[model samples]
Target: MSENIQKKIEDLREELHQHNYNYYTLDEPTISDFEFDLKLKELQELEKNHPEFYDSNSPTLRVGGEITKNFPTVQHQFRMYSLDNSYDFNDLEDWEKRVQKALNKPVEFVAELKYDGASISILYENGKLKEAVTRGDGFQGDEITPNVKTVSEIPMQLHGDFPDRFFIRGEIYLTRKNFDKINKRREEEGLDPFMNPRNTASGSLKIQDSAEVRKRGLSAVLYQYISSEFPAKTHWELLQKAKSWGFHISEQAKLCKTLDEVKAFITHWDTARHQLGFDIDGIVIKVNDLSQQRSLGYTAKSPRWAMAYKFKAEKVETELEKVTYQVGRTGAITPVANLKPVLLAGTVVKRASLHNEDIIKKLGLHEHDFVFVEKGGEIIPKIVGVNLDKRNPENPEIQYIKTCPECGTELVKIEDQAIHFCPNELHCPPQVVGRMIHYVSRKALNIENLGQETIEQLYREKLVENPADFYALKKEQLLPLERMAEKSAQNIISGIEKSKEIPFEKVLYGIGIKHVGETVAKKLAKNFESIDE
Candidate 1:
């Protein structure tokens, strides 16, 4: 009876894996959802009853109940370098010229959609999924193996010929349909809707619950295969091999023999991208020949053989309702345009940055004017231009504020700076709170649990005023604050304690000094032994 059960489990696992590949990778469902679910339920029941027949690569594992308290940081074997960006055909031509000049030969290209999502590096050993990591700083990233395993699009086991040990890098993205579904559920639950699919998908990977990660409906498209042994001679061929191995590859990916063909591919996708259920910000053009890629080599930050042609930012006409001023941590005053809510690039835009007085002047702002708002690089929303035809001549022109809105302090324009600054840096409320927030940020001391809201809450309660006061925080005092649980308070205290071991360079960066960035802080730390110097 036990032998019969083990055979049944193995057969079910293979059949489910094939069905998953067919539905997801091939875009063909061999069975209805109800039938699939029933089969899955039977297998799940059998597996639960017979623990001796457990298989790590079983389809049942995709449901994901594993909990990860902390994801361990692991160094990548091959450094995941970023691609150099090109805005126009001229830039692509220039890149092509440089590549040809270096190689002194004709070259072919592979054009693939640059998916706007979290970058992931997944390692497979002996045809089995071993580890998955994020593209943290190129050199190292957090190991999110359990979270990645939850993604049904990524095959847990290879089917065809593959390298003994290899790493496949790809983008993990949330489909537009799934994103909308999630937002709808969140809205019903009285929670703030996620800003975008890319951000939501990226954040899902870091979630402690593997079950939650599974529910996010994350998908991946493997683009690059890295290994010591060469499986194919060209990039396009590599993608084909990866697809045969049960990895999802983009069907839109095309091989271009010439730069003109590459341009045509980019031009086609620029408009047709809207039809895609997933978000793609641009096109990635790479030299097709593996030997040529290796010969072309890499620059300091990106691959010299490949280039990313970014599509122009999506622009939408919206009514500019009003203008607001914000004070930054450096006391720089920024003008913000409050707009009538308009959807652009899947996200609603209600406000956009005017950048400074110079940008405001360049745009020729007027009250109640219809303006062009675009997401700069598909992330930051900014007002690009004014729709003059729709602008009312009777409306008054918008002017930059002459004083700090937060403190009523007179603002002064610094020499060579475009934006006006509030000279009251020491006493400005925003600057003080911003500085404290910056001190515990990821690049700074990295005190966990000390988020912006918590800092603001502490400031409003009069429990803390500056970064120095964080060290004096007591568990008794924290427990009384809103939403402050005992474990959270203890975690914050522990994080604060751990931050003391951070390097002097990071400490210098955390101090919120004017013009002191991470690199500058590192340089200062190298020059001086202590802060006294």
Candidate 2:
């Protein structure tokens, strides 16, 4: 009787995995929703009764109940290099010339959509999903296997011929329909809606509850196949093989035999990208021959063979209600344009960087002027120009502020510098808080528990002023603050204590000097034996 039950469980798991592959990866569902749910329910009951037949990759695990407090960082077996970008056809021609010169031969190219989503690397062993990691700093990333497993598009078990062990890199994204649905629910519940699909998808992978990740309705599309011995000779063939093995490879990927064909592919997609269900910022072009790619080699940062062609940024016009200033850590005052909320690209734009006083003057910005807003590189919002025809005639010309907004001190503009500086570096609230925040940043001391809010609280209560003051903090002092519990307060102290073991270069960078950046700090550390030197 037990043997019969075990066989039934195994059969159900296989059947459900096939149904998932058919629905998500193939885009062709063999079973109806009602029928699939009935089978899933049956499997859940069987699995619940027989603990001995538990399988980690079983389709039942798709509902996701695992809670991960901390995602452990793991090094990639192969370095995940970023692609060099090409904004125009001229740039692509130059890149092609360089590649041809290096290889000394003709090469076919593979053109794939540059999906604007979080990059992920997943490992498979013996046709079963093993681990999934994010693309962090190229060398290492956080392991979020349980959260990734909840994505139905990623198969737990391979169907066809598969490698014994290998890693496949791809993108994890949320569809446009789901993104709207999520934001609609959030708006109804009186909560702040997500800014964009890319950020929302990335944030979902780090959520503590796997069940919550499933609710986010995430999807995956595998593109690149990595292994010690590739199954195919060309990049295009490898993608085809991956698709056959139950991976959700993009059907839109094309192979171009010449530069003209590649250009045509870009032209077609440049307009058609808006029609896609998910967001894509550009097109990724790569040399098809695997051997030629190996011979071309790579630069320090990115592969020499692959290049990304970014689309022109979408621009929109809105009313510039007013201009505000922000104080940086170095006392530089940056002008910001507060605009009437307008939708640019996929996200809503409420404010844009005016950069400095020079930019405001160049735009001839005035009170209640209509201005053009666009994402600089599909990333940061910037005011490009003013719609002068729509400008109000009676409005006053925008003037640069002479006094520091926070400290009420006279501002100074250095010769040859476009920015106005707040000379009151010592007592300015923003500068002081910015310095402390910079000190505990990831690249510097890497203090985990201490965040921007807690630092502001510490400053408000007069408990700390400088980075050095963090070392002298007591548990009792932190406990008195709002939302500070016994465990959280101890964790903050422990984090500060661990920061003492940071390297000399990081310590130098954390000191918050005006001109000393990470690269300069490393050079200084190499020359000087100690901090005093």
Highest TM-score among the candidates is held by which one?
1
Full-model lDDT for every candidate: 0.89, 0.90
- What does candidate 2's lDDT look like per residue over 1-533, in tens digits? 99999999999999999998899788899989999999999999999999999999999999999999899999999999999999999999999999999989989999999998899999999999999999999999999999999998899999899989999999999988988888765533223368788999999999989998999999889999998898989999999899888999998999999989999999998878767898888999999999998998899999998999999888999999888898877788988889999987657898998878889899888999999898743234888888989987999999999999999999999999898999998899988988888888766888887877899899999999999999999999999999999999999999999999999999899888878988899999999978789
lDDT of 2 at 53: 93
Across 1-533, the per-residue lDDT of candidate 1 in tens digits comes to 88888899999988998898888788889999999999999999999999998878888889999999999999999999999999999999999999999999999999999998999999999888999999999999999999999999999978867888999999999998998888765533223368788999999999999998898899899999998778789999999999888999999999999999999999889988877998899999999999999998998999999999999878899999999998888888888899999988767889997879999888889999999988754334888888899888999998888888999999999789898999888779888888887888766898888887888899999888888899999889889999999999999999999999999998999888879998899999999979899
Which stretches of model 2 miss by more than 4 angstroms?
A: 317-368, 375-384, 389-392, 396-533
Ten-residue region with minimum lDDT total, candidate 2: 184-193
Candidate 1 lDDT for residue 386: 89
Query: In model 1, what lDDT does residue 384 have?
Result: 82
